[model samples]
Target: MARAKTTYVCQACGAVTPRWQGRCESCGEWNTIVEEIVDSGVGAGPKSAVAGGRPVALVPLAGETETAARVTSGIKELDRVTGGGFVMGSALLVGGDPGIGKSTLLLQAAAALAEGGRRVVYVSGEEAVAQVRLRAQRLGLGDRDVLLASETNVEIILATLQNGPAPDLVIIDSIQTLWTDRVDSAPGTVTQVRTSAQALTRFAKKSGAAVVLVGHVTKDGQIAGPRVVEHMVDAVLYFEGDASHTFRILRGVKNRYGATDEIGVFEMSTLGLREVDNPSALFLDQRDRDAAGSAVFAGMEGTRPVLCEIQALVAPSPLGTPRRAVVGWETSRLSMVLAVLETRCGVRIGANDIYLNVAGGLKINEPAADLAVAAALISSLTGSPLPADAVYFGEISLAGGVRPVVHAPLRLREAGKLGFKSAVTGRLASSDQGGDLAITEYSELAALIGQIAAGGKKQAAE
Candidate 1:
């Protein structure tokens, strides 16, 4: 028997140190270092020569003879986000906050595939088979002949998939909860999470099974456990939404099969998770009629055109610091917009507590929302709101000039579909041909503010 050496690893950055430290020097996070034993007794020989496993050299996939076929994951919204569907033998990691529907989404997808006449197996590490059955019944999935198992051991999972009947799709309730006997650490630790993920990645490739791994997120929103877990997977999808809100978004952070920026929206209901086809309409629901401090923004998330509301409130701050708060939009980004208003537009809101929010619990990070933010601030400051059926999409510079945004035509077309009367954008001449909707363009923020204060009133009357 040989003794194993131990090394202290930073849980935050995965930097290994000889000894424990109070803080991780690489990531600057405090008290995140943990000691792990490095076992050196195992032989560094190829196990691929064994009867069960075979190895192949890596080569360019373009040289391979594999034909690209679109395999639906069974969830329509998820398929849209993933660029039609999951590729054959592709592995996906779905991560989200607790109670954010990560498990439910994958389970629903598995049921859908089973119903589509494809064999699907769901291995639950956290819940029992009965619990999974109960949830499946609620989702109206009884007609499908899906296999379910409640186990966390990686060997059992692999053996079941290998020797038993072939399944088209395989789903693990969570990757963090699964553990391998080879690793001496507990489940969800760096060693256990990384090792099991690597094994599953290999299994998915060899068995030609589309694997979906449910992942847990840390407090700061990164996938929990080892960083290597994300690297090992093929695609990383993040399920993001406020638990208080019914709408949840499945965004592809990384995708080997398709575009990474796609997003799928869903609404949680009593029957399970239901996909929202017309997300723009759902986002604009219950919008106030010609209300102050409100403006619509035509923003593009990935290739999808979304009409989101930008709500701003400019009120006197009771606090001495004049607080600045924003929901669904970055606070730092909002601060820059406020400074642009003060310097370029000459609409000072320094003493007032400015607050901005994106309606329908959807967060907007695109620069196209800049014009809408500016217009909302001005509408609140001057007490002259834009028309209820108006929307803005353009980026504002520090010097108050309007910058052109990407996909202006798509934004305008979607706005037209939503019955927006006006499309305020940087490309004024280009939008003149758009029938039925007024195209207003302003080079300077001050001029735009002036137009929005007066012209908005006229548009409302029309």
Candidate 2:
């Protein structure tokens, strides 16, 4: 008989170590290493009673194949974020902070799918059946012909799924709460999470059911578990929103069959999460047009163009090291923009407390918002209010030159659709016209700075 094997694994980063240590060298998380027995019964192991597999034929990359049909859940925003709809036999991992409405969104989608005559199974590991039913009733989806289960044992769940009619969609409330008899470690451990995910992914592929696994997020807003879980799934999405705000954003970071970096906006209400058909207007609603530090940014998320306000405040600081408080944007990007303004534009802006925010709680990731951020900062520094109808987008180089961004025509088209009359962007190709709006092209950041300062002077004079 082969001797049992034991190993130490880091719960935070899934790094395997021979011995336990104070902190994980990979993720720098403390006291996360745990010991577990390997080569267990359920999974594979060395010198075990399991048999070897046979080789299969390989196919060429270029081959004639039919595209798989997608199962629509009837929730437009959910379907949009999942690349038109959930593809059959694809596994997805969705992560979010607690109370951020991850369950509500998935529940809504499952109900929609069930109502559309698709067999849907919702297995809740975190909540009981009564709690889920209460929430479904609260969301007014109680009448939907959806099946629910409150279980966490992976074996039992798989057996249950296999015994019933093959479901079109299977939503697991959370992957962290799942445990398997194959892994001797506790639930939510690195081994268990990985094994459970692999089993479910295999199930999805074999049974042609779209598996949606919900995951909890850590304090740093990353999916709490081994990173391998993310790799096991075909797609990874994040549900993000602020508690104070009534809106939520479902963003896709990885997709094998669809575009990445896509977003779907939803508004939370007593009824449930409602899709925002026009996210540009939803993000820019109730704007303070006369605010000196506010500028609208025309940016893109995947294939969609989004317009949001960038607000800035620069005030004299009493402390030697002024505070740089930023929300909904990156601090390093802010620092880079500040350095460019001071070094290239000869602006003395570092000796103040700077605060920046993207209005309506929207987070921007693209570098195209550099021009908008700089404009907001300059506007606040000079007390100039950018035109409410004007939109800004472009990249700023360290040499203070404005670089053109992709999809300029699309951005301008979105601005025009929202009743914006003017656009300030980088040099546009001649073929790409302003399309019903006054367009201003800038090759250098200094030119826009001069224009904004001149506007401030002109406003002060008036």
Candidate 3:
């Protein structure tokens, strides 16, 4: 018998090296290189053997194709993030921090789908059948028709799945625990993960079933395993929430069939994950109109419009270097906003320690939040409260100009629906400014700063 070829693979990046090294040259990660037997099927083979394969029929790109059918989980929030529903023969990878309701959410979704008369199979590699049953009972899903299994061997799981009628949906509690006999590496290793994922993906495509694979996240919040696993999947969803908060966000970072930046909101409770139909109202549940540093921001998430509060605190610094603390927003973006305020608006806030936060643990990534954040910082520094019924949304350029953002009509419509009577935004086109809410357009950031400072002076005199 021929000796198996051994190679060193970097667990961080899946880069293979002939010899072992302390540090991975590809990803600069240390101690992540592990020795593994390279399967001949995975790597290059002999040229003589490859040349004997049958040729595949190639189709033109203009050929007609049918839209993939969708299997709705019956959870509105879950379905929304997945672009209406899970597509047939698609593989979705969901990742989250430990105990962040990943399993709970999937269980609830599985139960809902099962109750709707769809065949659903949940295979848990991390928990036993009894433990899963207990969880189902706790979540009030013990009576559902969802099939449960506790297995980790990829071959056995595939065989069992093939034995029954092809399930409408199959959920693996986590992909990390799955191992295959075809690979000579331990479970969760780079090689095993890649091999197992490829097998499951192939099964999904060939069997016409939606496969949902749970993934573990690294300490830095990235999906644990080789990045190639993410590439192999059809869609990637992230379940994010702070342990201290009950709200969980299901964000779609990649989707081949739908929008990539869509988000679905859920509130965790004793009953399981409850979908929030109006996420804007849930996010701004604890609004304090009298707070000086608080400003309401009308933002867009994918095609949906959301209103959130941006809070800022500016205080005298005791240290030579003032502190800058930010939560739910980027720190570097805050620095750029501060620089624009000082250089163009003459807001002497550099001497003060600044802290900014997006309420309800919701992270804002759009530049349209610039105007709201700037408004909050100025309000806090000048000790003035902004208009309670007004919403802010506009991007601030380095040259101190407030730029118009897309979805202006949607943002204003959502704000108006939530009882906001006025909005402060960039100059809007004539066609986009016909809403019931009074709109104030500002072209320069300095003008808005001057108005806020004047409000502060007026309040001080009173």
Candidate 4:
């Protein structure tokens, strides 16, 4: 016979304790420790008969096979992010800031699946059933096959999945709102979230359902609950964008089924979120033939190629400290690059207050954008316009040298697609091999300026 057992667990970080404490010593969270039952004599700490869950070893290749077909979610950008489409029985957690269109995106995906004759059930803990209907109506989605349930009880949701209709795709509006009866903790508690997630994961794997959980992000921009939550799921996705901008990016941080670096771009409208197929064109500035302060950059975000605009404004500083402000870039990096420009390139930027920004509100962490930022600043200060057909990429070193960036081939291909005839970048992986692109290999900032001023011919010949 098994012994009756119970334990207390912290709702913040999944730290288990013998008794409740006023504050959690492990995570330093207050009033989070809650009492819950634990079945003793299990493989791990405790077991439960009612839980009725067990783990099985992964079968040999010959014993099991995959049956998932790549189905487009009707959003081209989204399909690109998921490495073509969602795999069967795969669980994905999507998190973002509030009003970032996380729920709307899920509903859009659900509608697409349902319209294609696939079963999709959306369980909501935040909104009412009619409210969901209204949202669907706004998105022009009136499919009856896309079922809705407004409940937060994890047990009830599982029962519905068991006895009632089984869906091909399941969506939980927000994981923090769900609660399990087995745990005394409230909804969004670490124990409840973990336990509920475990049950859903079991259901998805056993029943061959594709489950999508809409998770909430803390003030620090991390997914709420234990870090184990991300580990438990098959994939983790983050939706991000400025509140003032209509564009949003859905990026995959972890993907077991596909590439993790993939991203999807979308546009918000009165109808709903619309997928942007050609993100490069949308992110690039479209104006007259030439602009002095603006330069084009061919940047790579994972497997995707994106073109963006870098803008710069330079003016003489009035105070002792020159003001340096940058958007979508690192300020310290800007300072370093500015110093390099002043010393190596002989650009008059030391006493100037330089302001820089990427035209779109998109954040760029890739070092490949460094060349564009530097070139834009120099062009603005010197009042020289980079040719409309030229794009820049490469990392800027403190010594004023251009360093090689990753995925050079993909970056060049993307830039070529945008009809750029020439690119100023660091030396390619192989210096001798040059096919279509007229690649200018610049070892230093001074060399790049000479090439850019010579209209690319003098540098290409060198």
TM-score of candidate 1 against the unseen true structure: 0.91
Off by over 4 Å in 4: 1-71, 287-289, 319-321, 339-351, 430-437, 449-462
Error of 3 at 36 (Å): 1.8
lDDT (tens digit, per residue) of candidate 3 on 1-462: 978888899987789998999999998889999999875434334536565779899988997899889999889888998999999999999999999999999999999899999999999999999999999999999999999999999999999999979999999989999998888888998888888999999999999999999999987899988999999999999999998899999999999999988999999899898989999998889789999999999998888999999999999999999999999999999999999999998889999999999999998899999999999999999999999999999999999999999999999999999999999999999889888999999999999999999999999999
At residue 139, candidate 1 shows an lDDT of: 80
The list of candidate 1 runs beyond 4 A from truth reads 40-66, 428-435, 453-462
Q: Please, what is the whole-model Cα lDDT of each candidate in the order they appear?
A: 0.82, 0.93, 0.93, 0.82
Off by over 4 Å in 2: 1-3, 41-45, 48-53
In candidate 4, position 372 carries an lDDT of 88
Which pairs of residues collide in model 2?
Answer: none
* Candidate 1, 408-444: lDDT as tens digits: 7788889999888887878555544566678887777
lDDT of 4 by residue, 1-462 (tens): 966566777777778888888999998889878776554211146333656568878766676676665566878877877877877787889999999999999899999888889888899999999999998888888655688899999889989977766688899989999987776656787767888888888888987788999899877678888888899899999999888889999998898888887888899999888888888988874733466678888888778888888888888899899888888888888888888888888877789888988877877877788898888887777666787887899998888888988878777788788788888888777743454778887888788776555653443466
Instruction: Report RMSD (Å) for each prediction in the order shown.
Output: 3.9, 1.7, 1.5, 5.3
The lowest-lDDT stretch of 10 consecutive residues in candidate 1 is 39-48
Q: Give all TM-scores, in the order shown.
A: 0.91, 0.97, 0.97, 0.83
The clash number for model 4 is 2
After superposing candidate 3 on the true structure, give the runs of residues whose Cα lies further than 4 Å from its correct spot: 41-48
Ordering by TM-score: 2, 3, 1, 4
Q: What's the CA RMSD of model 1 in angstroms? A: 3.9
lDDT of 4 at 288: 34
